[model samples]
Target: MGARGQGRPVAVIGAGAVGTSVASALARAGRPVTVCGASRRIERIEVTEDGSTETWPVAQATVPDDITGYDTAVLAVKAHQTDAAAAWLKAVSAPGTTVLVAQNGVEQRERVAPHTDGAYVVPAVVYLNAERTAPGRATLRRVGRWDLVLPDEAPARALAAELSAGLMRVGLEADFATVAWAKLLGNITANPLTALTGRRVDVLRDPGIGTVARLITDEAVRVARAEGAALSAAHAREVLAWLENAPEGATTSMLQDRIAGRPLEYDALTGAVVRAAERHGIDVPVNRLILALTSAIHPGQ
Candidate 1:
């Protein structure tokens, strides 16, 4: 079925960088899409990706109630802003709504499930490096395939098929928890460290920062394993290696939020690791320190 069986009505909430990129790509592909929520009244979108820039018209950005019809609502807001998306959820989501949560961390389903009752909550590991230059205008510096982890349901398979045929590549994963936590292990450390340092990910090239990253990730991986994610120390090291070798100026979402003076996602990323570790009787001292530092500095919390 297409967009909850209504056929081709896709609403992408939170017209930030990632949301704008996803909506622009879908609409440009003649997929009948809308870019909405907490954004200016955008008549069109300008996107730059893969050495090419394209502009596409879309339904003007609007509130949730303004969505006359929609089958798929992609929740692309920051994890901490689920409350905002909750209101939008009630506006556009129906019993058959498919809510694709494109956010950081492993708590996508938990964060969004309470709002969109009876909807298919699919957690996606987003791997795109798109930046919002202005409202309704975004630049995709790099693009990576989105991985959707969902139950082997017909709707999920159908949605996966639809998204895969866009400017964005998409794949389906059978073991979502493993994938989510593994992604989180990489996200949790880099975001907080980058936000704290106000620097790009390559700062991990420093031995001191790299050691802190490993120590924190080591504890986080233990908690992930306790929570049945099957993450290992080697996996944590691999994540660190990736960060160390990241492009010189590559920044994380948390770092961008800090730079832009927006509320940081402390609770969702690092805070989630700390809370999970507690449940497993594991210690995450480094993560705790990083969380406290970032929280103390983030004015909007």
Candidate 2:
């Protein structure tokens, strides 16, 4: 604990690529960190530039019971898995434990709020594209800072600094809603398109496929505005530009889930846009089609 004030251990709820990365970052910073989840597999991780490499053990525990005594918990599970993760947090952690959500989409904080006892729920919008290449190996596609959006209050800033210090680069944003919506704008396009077409992100950026990407992003931008998230058209344009410039070999998480035949976070990424469109009384025809296509591809999801 660097600059510590009540040093409760840090727990990462899911040891997937994102969870492992966060846990490794904290553990590298000399914090007491444990990763808890149902997966019993052990993983060997090598952290970036910090020379932190360790064999990470995944603790076995079921939902709503496994979450335990850590002062800070980072929920890095997929968006659809958030409810069960929240329930676990409620059963395990004491009140006032900070819960940081490191998932895609904008609804994780809201989803986790009902279960936890008014714990400081920090909604983080992740930017780095990390993937589980093997059981214990994950590769980082982007080396970017983690952006955490919380109130400017002392507690929030202090928590941000504590979580960020000596780990990955962390930035505090006053308008967190805007940051989340902007990240959502980026995620909404690549994920669904890649899942639906079974194409890698590079292939999806072709002129024909690029049009579909634009359509989905445009609809998400509209919904973000309707929800008062303060995103702009330029954000949507930038999303497209990023897609065009992204590594051709890169595959979205949705694509990975589809190939593995595991449940996808469709409900959060693309399905979220569809729900938001209905809420705003706006037409999201392209998004609806993408959702249908992706869902059809994953039948029974």
Candidate 3:
């Protein structure tokens, strides 16, 4: 179960874009990794840099009852899929298993805690812009690094160091809350706006769309402030400015889901904002409108 010395058996629960990318990086680092919860068609072509891949032929990928004897389990599934994935973790994971959550949003640890049996749940903020171009192939749009937020534990730091040594950059930050909220602010601007307008990130450069992007950023900043997360107006503006400079054809994941007719993460991203606004006793009409529009388009949730 343990990787003698520095090596560890890593099981990636989801073989989506993020999951495949992380599994590749871990394999490149000589960490024995296996990807589960994907179709055999994808599994056959799920080639890591080190040429290691496994096809988990299971109907419910979130169920971990079939997965066994892995040191670390990385949950790269969607936010809504976390509950089912956690149920599987509880069934299969051992006490010493380390669960690294590489999904977006700030509440992943909370969502997975109930299903884990005393496993260390480490929250991580991934910064790579990866997209699945094919069933098993993912294109790395931006080779950004990963920022990890770990509990005050030595084993967590050791794990971070090992993963950081891979291809992309990796860093551990003491103020994990700030790091997470910062990424959320960026996501708030790019995701919902693209989903609502059916435009790419560069659409923000248009003066009319730019104004809406600013509004979204402004509301997110207010909610973050109300949540006691230290995010400034300047930070929000910086996020908007970055979107303005992004590629003209850079569509967000939400937009991509819309094109593919899959369920979007509107509830997790924009819906989270509404919940946060309620907690702060602040009304975010702009984000509320965006959320409503996106939800209307999908109507799957």
**What is candidate 3's TM-score against the reference?**
0.86
Residue 13 of model 1: what lDDT? 82
Instruction: Quote each prediction's TM-score.
Output: 0.91, 0.86, 0.86
Greater TM-score among 1 and 2 belongs to 1
lDDT of 3 at 91: 51
Q: Any idea what lDDT model 3 has?
A: 0.70
Could you tell me which residue pairs clash in candidate 1? Answer: none
Instruction: Name the runs in model 3 displaced over 4 angstroms.
Output: 3-7, 43-63, 143-155, 247-249, 299-301
Candidate whose lDDT is highest: 1
lDDT for residue 122 in candidate 1, whole number 0-100? 76
RMSD of each: 2.4, 3.3, 4.0
Worst ten in a row by lDDT for model 3: 54-63
Q: Write the per-residue lDDT of candidate 3 for residues 1-301, one digit (tens) a residue.
A: 6453346557777767777677666766767665566655444324332234433221233335556766777788878788767655775466777877888787877778778777878887776666666665665555223434454466567667666665546677777777778788878778877777777777778898888878887888889888777889898887777667664355677777777777788777778878989987998999899888877885443
**Clashes per model (N, Cα, C within 3 A):** 0, 1, 1
User: Global lDDT of each model?
Assistant: 0.76, 0.69, 0.70
Q: Name the candidate, 1 or 3, with the larger TM-score value.
A: 1
User: Which stretches of candidate 2 lie above 4 Å from their native place?
Assistant: 1-7, 43-67, 143-155, 299-301
Clashing pairs in 2: 64-88
Candidate 1 to truth, TM = 0.91
